[model samples]
Structures are given as structure tokens and as C-alpha cells.
Target: MYPSSLFQALLLSATLVPNVFAQSSTTTDPTQRAELALSALQIWYNAGSGLWNTCGWWNSANVMTMVSNLAKHDSGNAQLVNLATRIFANTIVQAPAKNPQPGVESQSATKRSNGNETYDLFNSTGKESGYYKMIGEDAEPITIFPKDWDKAEYIDVKNLPIMQPKEQVTTVAASNPNDWLDGFYDDDLWWALGWIGAYDVTKDTQYLTLAEGIFKAVTKAWPTACGNGGIWWSWQKDYMNAIANELFLSTAAHLANRVQDSDKAFYVDWAKRELDWFTNSGMINERGTINDGLTNDCKNNNRTTWSYNQGVILGGLVELNKASPDATYLPLAARIAKAAISELSDSDGVMHDACGPLCGGDASQFKGIFARNLQILHDAAPDAAYVKSIQANAGSIWDNNRDEGNMLSINWAGPFIAPANASTHSSSMDALVAAISVN
Candidate 1:
């Protein structure tokens, strides 16, 4: 059972009665909710011209997925389809390198011909500091020349035989952990769900096949790429992240239930164990402000709330609720949602400005995650008061975050297209679809 004090705090902060919506049985109005989310996506698409072109990451795919899903629900909106197609057309598929010829002459010629090319696949470009170039891939370099270098050292194939210089290492060392976490799985998880969500509305099994293949790859990559259980926080070789585990578990559960794969049960159980540990370990306070995802085995350490943790785990719990139907779990989740919107969310609908130091310096920075979670909650619980509150607040927040170009930052304004863009969960889009779903 959850602490009553925490429940009371949630209500008190919101200036409302405890579980006020619980007294009423109606789910949220799906159409109005979807329309609000759709408007956010439309804003993103109109502004994110550069993001749409440099694809393969969440930026383009996310918005595209939302736009496509919206088209299914509001068929009268012809522009949504056009925007989705445009985003898809801008994606990049990196070509795999072909094997070099076996002949010594060909090898020698190949070496000599390529001798002028100084960039190493594993080394840093100093342009996009943390990103490494693929040796044989067609990645365009912004700073290949010595003059173009940002006062950073460039290692040539001839001189740096043993190791790349410290300057190069520092550039990578200074890379942000959060950005690494964002790209760690590439598109495997999102693509799979993207296919599933698309299939649900379109009756097309191709999306299902895409999802299956992506899940298979994600499972295979678990141990190393994401550290044993796909639980690492920032793609760092050193630290293991609890948030990543939460997301992986949630994604794994979704896939497992959809396909009825027993192997996924292992992942699901691991997630439950971790989540149980988190709740008991005080990652969740009595007030229901969930600590940002944990570091493995570092109890009595610093843990602060991030909007992603509160919302994403709740989403996972919703899926778990569907599978198991525990009455207590949903109420617990509802209570947690209450804390999220009241305590963590700002009066204007952004999240995590109240976090302590362990939550990191940038904790107050990400408004998008909060918006996405609000979207998640609307889908899961659909409380009228919460819906009305979020819709009013979110519109202003969305408008505030919009840049002159109208496109928002992934870290800042991502929620408008988050369901489609951020994680490929089609969360925003799925929420829209769920709104339209009559069952």
C-alpha cells in the first residue's frame, strides 16, 4: 500500500481533492486530447526542417510517426499524410562496407589511393565532438582540414599508430551522458513498436515483421551494447543506468505481450525486480516524486526525480496492469501520476525544476519529457480534471518553447512530436490513436 501522506500531498499541491476523478468512471475524451497532441506535432513539423533532413536518429522519425498516426485518426487532415511522407523521404540508411579484394596489387593500390584520406573511423572529428566516423561509410566531415580543426589535435594514420592523442580523447570524454543514452539503442526498439502501432491501425503486417526483426536484434544487443540487460544510462562503458533498464523493461514487456515470447519474460522479470528494488529503496519518496533512474547497487546515494522516470515507468506499469490486472498497481500508478503533475510539474506544465543536485544540473532543462509523461498519463488514466489542467498548461508551454523557426529542441520542446519522434514508441501518436480507439 502507498503512504497516505504522499497521496494527501499530491492532492494538496494540486489544490484538489484526493483522487477526485476516481469518484467518476468516464475515461478522458480521446478526440480533444489527440487534437491537442496533433497541434503540437504540427508545430514541430513546420519548424524542424534541418532535423528532418539529418535523419536516422529520433528527430525525424519521431515527428513522422506522430504525423502518420494522426492521419489515421483524423482522415480529413490531408496535410498530416504529406508531412509524414516528407519526413520519411529524408532518412539516411548508412551503407555497409564491402570486403576489399584479396590480391596484393589491389590491396597496395587501395592503400595508396586512400593514403590522402586522414580520418580514422574510430577517431573524433572534433566537429560533432562525441560522434565517431564510420571508416567506409559516406559520413560527410565538417572539419577534415588542419585549418578547420577547432584548435583540437588531428591524428594521422602514419603518426598515431599506437593511440589517438589526448585532445581527441578529451573531446569524447567531455561528451554528455544524456545524449549517449538517447542514441544507445538506435531505432531498434522504436522501429518495432512503430511497426506494431502502425499495424494496429492500418491492418498491415509489414510493421509487425519490422517490429519482430528489430526486437530480435535488440535482444541480441542487450548484453554488451546496453550492458547485460540493456540497462546502461549513457552508453558509457563504466556506469550502469537504472532508467535505461526501466525503458528496456517497458519496451521488452510491450514486445513480449504482443508476440507472446517466453524469452522476453526474463527481461520482464528483471524489470519487475529492479522496479521493486527502486520503490522499496526510496527511489520513490512518500510524496511520490520518483528519483531519477538509479545507478546499480548504489543505495544511500543521490537520486532525484526526472520526468522521464515518473512517466515512462508509469507507462510500463500500465502495460503490466493490462497483463496482470492488479487493482492495487493502477491506483499506485495513479497516485504517482498525481505527484508527477503536482510536485514535479511546474504550474505551466513543464517538469523537474524542483529536483536536487543528484538529479544533475540539467534536471530543470528538459520540459519535453514532462509533456510526454502528461501525454502518457492522459492515455493511461484519462481523468477529466487532469486532462483539462494539462491541456491548458501544455498549450502555453508548447508555444513558449517554440523557436523562431518554429522547430523545438529535442531536449527542450520534444513532446509535441515526442510520441512519434523521441523514442519511436509513437507515444504521442499512440495516445492519439488510443483516443480514437473505440474498444
Candidate 2:
């Protein structure tokens, strides 16, 4: 439920660790270093599907956008343009429409403490349980490319029929638009971010309009009911949390900076209102880091600040600074970035979330979001240490987390410990591609 490319793991890094970016600045050319790391990750792209071999709709959406962003910046790869073209074609046509296929569905009717947050979506056995694919999904089967694809298990798809959409109703999430929001506000935001990235690369008015349209509709749900002015975690409106609101603020601010003349002011006003309300809302706890959300009574809920929660907001703040040019926004972003890097990472300095390895689809996408935003922060603020952190993460990803098939594990800390999925792979790809921006 987060940033699109991760748009997930990019949160805080400048505070805890020493200047990793600053130190790395003296090494080989920053672009070259980034190119090498990025080149390693290129193996994951699938020509057949016009997507990264990432399996799920949300993950593939992120991978496509991340690849697009990288292609835009990486001068070494002229071919990335062609790849982005192929990928976008696939993304649009394959996008799940209103109704879903037989036996594939979302389970929004299930009761829970937090809508879609309390339980794991699928069975570990990866089998079906009727009316639901896996327990966590609010609906039926979506397509999931398996981990084997990363290992060159089926390379022929790159040339011929691009990977066919294999309907995976067993343990996947919903795919269609009607229920795409499926009570999870953050999921919608994640998809919107992907569209935003697509818009960024193509200059296609349609992509920007699509993202802006989602933001327009989503903001309608920002109820002021709880004294806490934040987006609800789910469409069910049962809970309000950090990631969703952070995504909301950043996304609105980003769209404000990008949209055409008529819509700009509306998004800007929304961004400002959200930032002012959020900063004073007590979600950014005493730790100088953000907590999950307010309690039902509107007190600080004190939930663990997952890496993604910390990661997503920086982009909003940076864009807001550009829009309004206020001195305060960058400092706020810098302070949080410091806290995230120092506090949220593992011993090796790779970013991680509060969820650990058991983190399913949503959490799987966290760290990459952190990495991408961290680079953004660094670019705007000139935090060289952030580059060091990015470099460290790139090295660790290759050394400890990547598998024989080149798929990345969920934990950057290592052991290939969990079920390797597209979410994890794309999140790592975010960090890897981000290596180019810094030294």
C-alpha cells in the first residue's frame, strides 16, 4: 500500500549512519557506478510481458515505472526507451477491467481489526480457500509471475509471446478496477504513483490525467471526522494510518507540481492542507521519525514506523518546496530522512521496514520506495551520505540478498529467507537504479 516504484522503501537515512553517500562520492564516477549496479538489475526485465518479471499487478506497475524512470535518467541505455514502450503497451492492455475472471476475487467482506491489515492475504500452501484466493485478498485471482522467471527459468518469453497472464487465484490480490481500491486506500495510491511515473516518462497527457483523476477521486475520502485530518487506510473507512496519508500528501504535491494550468492550484492547496495538518497531527513522534497512525481516539497510535511510511513523504515535501519554495519543507524532509537512515536500517545500513521477513505484498514493496525517495532528497538537498547509503545497499543486495536466478529477497539483510516475489524484486530494483544519482 505505498509508493509506486516503492516509491516503498525511500524514507529516512541521513540521521543514523555516517555519510555513506559523502564517502562514496570520491570513488569512480557516480553515473558509472550507478550504471554498473543498474546493469546487473537489467536481467530482471522481461521483454515478453513488457514488464519486469515481477508477478503481481501492483508490483509490475511499480517495476514498469521504476524501469521507465531509470531509462529516462540512464544515458547509457538507449534501448530502455524501446523497453519502456513495450512495457507500457502491455501494462495498459493487460490492466484488469471491471469484472474479474471465475474463481479470482477480492475478499472485502471479511471482518477485521484493520481492513485488509490484520491478516495474511493468502495461505502459505499457496492453494485456494473458495470465494477467496488467499485470505488477505479482498478479491479473486490476479496474475503473478513466479520467482523462477528471474533465474532465466523461462527466458523464451522475452522474444515470443511475452509472459502470458497466468490467472493466479490461489494467493493473489484483486486485479480489476471496480474493486481495485478494495478498501485499501494505499493500494490505490500505489497504482496512482505508477501512473504518475508513466506520465513523467512519456509526456503522455493521458497518464498524467489518469493519475490526477485518481487523486481527485481519492481526496473525496479525506474525512475530517476524527480531528485527525488524514486519509483512511481502507475504503472501509475503519482506520487511518501513516502510509496512506503520506502517500496522499506526496502524491498531491507531486501532481500539483506536474499538472497543467487549470488543476495545479487545487492539488497545491490539497498538499498544503495535508502537510500542515499532518505535521501537527503527532504522527511524527518524538523520535523525529513517524509512527503508524493516530489511535481511534486520535492520540498517537505509536505503531512501528515501517520504512515505507518514512520513505514516501519526502517526495511530497521536496515537490512542495519547489512549488512553494518554503525553507521549512526541506528541513522537515531532512530531519525525517536522518531519522530513517539511522534508525530504520539493518546493521549493514540497508533500509528495512518494521514488518521483517513475514511482510507480505505491501511490506515487500517498502524499501525500494525508501531508496528512490532518498535519492530524490539527496538530489534536492545535496546529502552526499545518502549516496554512501545507496552504494552500501547496492553492494549488500548483490552480495547477500540476490538469488541464483537474480531475484532479490525481501530482506536486504539476506539469506533469501522469504517467498521471493515481484514486490521484493521491484523494491530492490528501486534501490539499485537509484544508485546513479549519487556518487
> Candidate 1 — worst ten consecutive residues by lDDT sum?
94-103
Worst 10 residues of 2 by lDDT: 7-16
Misplaced by over 4 Å in model 1 are 1-56, 59-61, 68-129, 132-203, 216-230, 234-237, 260-282, 295-297, 300-304, 348-366, 398-439
RMSD (Cα, Å) for all candidates, in order, is: 18.0, 10.7
Question: Which regions in candidate 2 have their CA more than 4 angstroms from the true location?
Answer: 1-55, 98-181
- TM-scores for all candidates: the values are 0.53, 0.73
RMSD (CA, Å), candidate 2 to true, equals: 10.7
Q: What does candidate 1 score on TM?
A: 0.53
Against the hidden true structure, what lDDT does model 1 obtain?
A: 0.40
Q: RMSD in angstroms, candidate 1?
A: 18.0
Number of clashes recorded per candidate: 7, 44
